[model samples]
Target: MSQDYDKILKENIEALILPLADKLLGLSLGRLEEIPDDIQTTLERRPDFLKRVISSNSHESYILHLEFQVKDKAAMLNRMLLYYAMLKEKYGESIKQYVVFMGRRKPRMSTQLKEGMIDYRFSLVDIHQLDYRKLLDDATQPEQAVLAILSNFKKSEVDTILPEILRKLQALTNNERKLRRYVRQLEILSNLRDLQKETIKHTEAMPITYNIEDDIRYQQGIKYRKRQRRKYRGNY
Candidate 1:
């Protein structure tokens, strides 16, 4: 992943993580306390998110560990097991582990490992398999709104999808400066799905006003459009 992508993920994961925990994992979290992710053991390992959550209904509390996986690594199960051991030893509480797969391709990572009398597993959710509309509607923050693109929206045309995303983002954001930042985040994530150009095109058609000349991304997009015009003329 590019540094920009990593930066976006690190910054905006809080928006995506909680909702996924609630809707997918069925974690009826009443209280979610951020736990220190740095585990100091034989090997130092840091998880993406570690939280102590109390169930709203049952009043049960446990350690919830969620990893945002961009690639399908075969050793993911082993890695989770290691983190499981470290967290269990440190916290001495019930631990639930989940991996949120965000890659464009199908995930082939194993979620469970078993031995005689030893059973271990982690929940794996392919983000693309989720309904994008539901995810978008559930989004409370602009950061979360941008992530709806990463979810399952292939059933809908890109023509149809990008506008709604931008519109929802427009409704959620009041600050132009923050809106530009969120647009950049959306642009970067859209690249993963090969929809950056469409995202820009849809934004151009939308009514939201912003200084495109002031933004490097829009400027490059403008140049690309000009190039396309020249190419079409030359072809004719």
Candidate 2:
């Protein structure tokens, strides 16, 4: 990743919006599979560029075009319209279009008003609007739990609420369970808790490869997965 503002923004989108797409749009992508082919370089420039183009066979074997916007800007709907038109022109109308906004605050979106236009408009997901605490309360509902962690929540909060959060997260869809286990494994792999001041002081003398961002995200994914697994195991 480029050591620039775009890199930070892209990382946040990878950790935040991509998961939302899976939960809300029924689309899934690998950890580093988000680099869009059509407009990869443009996105790194923080320009209002396109995200990715992919094909899937989940329901009817269609293409997935995804965009991750960190903040709101002028003429967003117009840009959305342009993206839709461009993708359809390039890949035919059969490809599905999905644009998600994980901005800190929700923006007012104008209704699609183009005449004779039949296209899938963007879907907005405001990170600030998501309630991680409420999702933790609904751990029996793994989907919401997954949504909660995947949404934007402070790291400090995750630490304090982990146990209870884990308790509620144990119930999710079967596929969600499998994904949860994968997340748990990442948490162990990241060993993020070792970043604590106490731990850091002791480990400062040694070489550490743990990245706080990776560990937190790994824990979040694991929590979502573990909750589903627990639900499947009937431990709820």
Candidate 3:
């Protein structure tokens, strides 16, 4: 992933909801107890999504682990395997791991490792392959509704889908300030699909306003990203 998209990913990690986790990542979990994800024992990085969730089907407790992957980097499986081991040691519970790939290209990275005496694998899903409408259909809150931006939708449908998402956000969140944050999130995630312009146009049309000049993500972090063209692109 480029630096710009990576920044967007970091910004949205906390915002990405469990409804996305359950559907996109295929984990039927309930009553999640979020645990600290920053357990950097040997590696310098932390897991993107880590929580103790009760299995909705079995009614058992286990660790639900998920990661948002934008790039098919080398040694990706190695990193996940490492995470599995670290999380297993810490939590001592059965684990479920998944990687939600949101990059432009098809994912080429291997998801399993079958060594001489070991067999390990993790679930990998491409966000573009899922149905965007179904995501909104399952969404019960504004946070879940905003994630529809990352799911599969056509170029012509940008005007349609984005507006629906904004409307859902408006209906769910009676708070204007909260709606603006989801607008900012959609603006950032739309770049991964190369639909930033359309996202901003419809978002600007909404009743709530998203002030890019005041948003710290727009001013400080996304400043050097030249590919993400907008009205404020040249201002900073």
Candidate 4:
């Protein structure tokens, strides 16, 4: 169950990066570039999303490192410092780092490290603190609409927003295949905010189409079974 939840969380966060980078980073980005994910520290620690974005104003480019967290972890600040050191070593550019907490509870994680001669810090944001209406108002991007469910939406607004979000997602897609994928993503993200029932209720009325095989979780299950079969056959 934990694994399934983590998978959904990862997919939801990744899907929104393209559409919500500016909002997430609080900067108007000109051109967004994905950095290679294989960069590792000497100790073999891999960091999360590392991006190169050009500032909308000034036209200057910088590195944006983002780490998404569902719960507070011990020594997270140390980990971020390690990642920052490794990233600075490789890119040789100014790197701005941020940690986005997706959990419903208030974040208690440390965002800075202050000791003798070493002062390091990074920005921390909680998704629930953000205003949901901003995302709901963005009609051009379906990703924002989907993410708005996890934001600070009032309980009274759920009925109205959920249906509208589903309608917008369906209209954004051109074919049944794409529509299903979006719906599946919406379902997964809604679960994070404990609105799975509302999501199902709204999506059922829409003409969204999806295949079991097209879903990533289903595909992963198939791969896991294949690996298990291969191992059993070898033992036989």
User: Using lDDT as the measure, what is the rank order of every candidate, best first?
Assistant: 1, 3, 4, 2
TM-score of each: 0.81, 0.43, 0.80, 0.78
Give the poorly placed runs of model 2, Cα more than 4 Å off: 1-5, 9-18, 28-59, 116-120, 128-236
Instruction: Give me the candidate number with maximum TM-score.
Output: 1
* lDDT at 163, model 1: 80
Candidate 4 residues lying further than 4 Å off, grouped into runs, are 1-15, 41-45, 56-59, 210-236
CA lDDT for candidate 4: 0.74
Which candidate leads the pack in lDDT? 1
lDDT to native, each model = 0.80, 0.46, 0.77, 0.74
Error of 2 at 175 (Å): 28
Ranking by TM-score: 1, 3, 4, 2
- Predicted candidate 3 versus true structure: per-residue lDDT over 166-221, tens digit per residue: 88888888777877776776777787788888887887777665566856456655
Segments of candidate 3 deviating more than 4 angstroms: 1-17, 36-38, 56-59, 209-212, 215-236
Candidate 1 lDDT over residue span 112-186, tens digit each: 889898799998988777678788888888887898888787734888878888888988999777787788788
Candidate 4: 10-residue stretch with minimal lDDT: 1-10
